[model samples]
Target: MTPHHGFTPFFTGDSYISPASKPDWLASALPTLTFYPKAIGVVWRASRQASSGRYDSRHWCESSLNIVRSLETVGCRLRVTGIEQLRKIDRPCIFIGNHMSTLETFVLPSLIMPWVEDLTFVVKRSLTEYPVFGHVMRSRNPVVVDRVNPREDLKTVMNEGGKRLAEGYSLVIFPQHTRTVQFDPTQFNSIGIKLALKNNVPVIPLALLTWAWSPGQLHKDYGPIIPSRTIHFAFGEPLHVSGRGTAEHQQIIDFIQGNLDNWHRQDSD
Candidate 1:
């Protein structure tokens, strides 16, 4: 359907930090009984639209903005930086980053969709099977892998990902094999770099912290909403892929690790 109220103007700046003041003063004093529900409601509606073939990037952005609003309503702060980097490229590119929680899957579209009209993700096949959310994911024409076999996954990405990029759809690939709350550099892979290099596209590094949506003990994607924790997404400059992608891949890892460390330090202070 239509975009969330003011979705077009909410993220017009190069960077955005949720205001220190909560949007709803009444909701602020209450417990997080409504946070997840509000976020899920918008997503469910978007899913239904997606299933009906009516959903597109604008709809995706609307649902994402609503989730951001839901988080802010409950006092969970969000900080975004380097959004201008999205405008740095005139052509579609690969976005590689660490996979931390389910939060990025919901919120990233709102940040990137304004600049890049055509975008999709390289996600695990399981994400395409998720209930209502899965419908939205599938509609995006994502590059899906089983995440079981590295060799097969790479083949799937290169073969399928190359087509999407050629069609001018930017791909957001989380190279971490297993999504974790903790940032582990060793688990990060180089598949995104390989895909970018193979297709002759630039790779933009994304660093995000979504600990506010704690990875669930029972349901990995459905998690507890902690309003005290802040959310952050930082976009790094686009690095042109060359050679074997060794240095570019390491640079992506370093960018993510450095941001995670800095955010942790700030939260502790």
Candidate 2:
């Protein structure tokens, strides 16, 4: 838990995790069942604080980092790269990435907020309406979408997201309508790229491998977590959108696809 100035963003250098080397036999088997509740508890507390108007930007950032640190303490190691690229950007930009799982939704703020300071997400409308947690998310003033209507969602993101960017707020947008363990380039939308291009802001591509946080059978967020599964995030160099944004959109797809393929091979090896 060092200060943000000295933080390197990597919880552990090694991305490969071997079950044979695990020291805790009991905890290894029930990783998901054991840790997810605690993570939810952290969210609950944060939501309550936010709902009570006691939560500020600093508190929000600290709570997010605390959640990631707590998860690390419970055996989920993280390996983050390209943080220097984020630090180099003086102005706010739109962060576009593949939506893998709820893990990124919970953990990303810790990684991005410390560097950017002011950050929010383009989330599903239900997320902002979710009981208990909704208040916390709404407080951040995210661009909420219904998913049922792409046209309306795009309008909301363009209108709201553009305004936020104008105010120096960086946005994290998961172009995929839903989170999936596998990356599906077809389902990935170009709204984030369009927003960035229209706003004349740089688009920072993010690639994340968060399948370590498994989706639950009953509740997606509270799923099985393989402690031996390492979390990976790699941020690509910023791209300034030009013309129709088709090139930039494909570039983002390639960035995420390449990272996921490489990471999957490494983890399987």
Candidate 3:
């Protein structure tokens, strides 16, 4: 792939994937055993391409999509909606969502990239220090922060996130300090909302049920692939920041809780 200076912002109908049918038990079991190796290979190749300066805008988005599609081969079912809200936005916005499984970290780019070309995450500083994965993540110029020292992390997000937004880059922020299967409204802070308020940008509330990839006993990212758990992602209409971010923060929490409750109920039925 040729290296392009600017990020590519293009997607197809396939990009909004909603698989026709679910996979069988045997098919899902096979991927559970092979997914770790497959993921390593995929990230390694993408790292090399990025290090060589060959991974440009198109390559970046395509590689992410390939990883998500690979999971589908193992019978993972995914549904994404609210692209229309994303398309209507003319400026960069802060995407705030509840942190779920490691699945969202790997799969979200494919869902968001086509709509917003210049996209990056507000990630923990340690993630940018990983072996091959670090290289690929750094190539995208994500805002990195140390989870310790809330004051410092907030400062970093405000400073770095502001610069990125100024350059027309949208940021994804997970307010929960860590990932968990269950959503805790108390743990979901207002960092993302504050960032949006400071930057004078809109906040796009994101709700996702990505339990298809559960946490591993050893390596959290190398978890069992639960193809039966249908992955879902929803983006709410952007809310413009007003006076204090208190109201906006509560609004985001409510949005996430409402969606998660509905999804869980549907799944239980």
Which candidate should be chosen as best, given lDDT against the real structure? 1
Query: Best candidate, TM-score-wise?
Result: 1
lDDT of each: 0.86, 0.80, 0.81
* TM-score of candidate 3 against the unseen true structure: 0.91
Q: What is candidate 3's lDDT per residue for 28-92, written digit by digit as tens?
A: 55878756676788889989997887776566677777778778877877777776677766778
TM, every model:
0.93, 0.89, 0.91
Backbone clashes per model, in order? 0, 1, 0
For 1-269, candidate 2 gives per-residue lDDT tens digits of 22243444433332323223332554566665666677778889888998989876666766677777656656777778776667666678989999878888777877677667478999988889888888889988788888999899999999999999988789999998788887889999999988988889899999999887888799886677776788899888999999999999999999999998888898889
- Listed per candidate, the RMSD to the true structure in angstroms reads 3.1, 3.5, 3.4
**Alpha-carbon lDDT of model 3:** 0.81
Off by over 4 Å in 2: 1-26
- If the candidates were sorted by their TM-score against the true structure, best first, what order would they fall in? 1, 3, 2
Query: Which residue runs of candidate 3 sit more than 4 Å off their true CA positions?
Result: 1-17, 21-26
Off by over 4 Å in 1: 1-9, 23-31
Candidate 1 — which pairs collide?
none
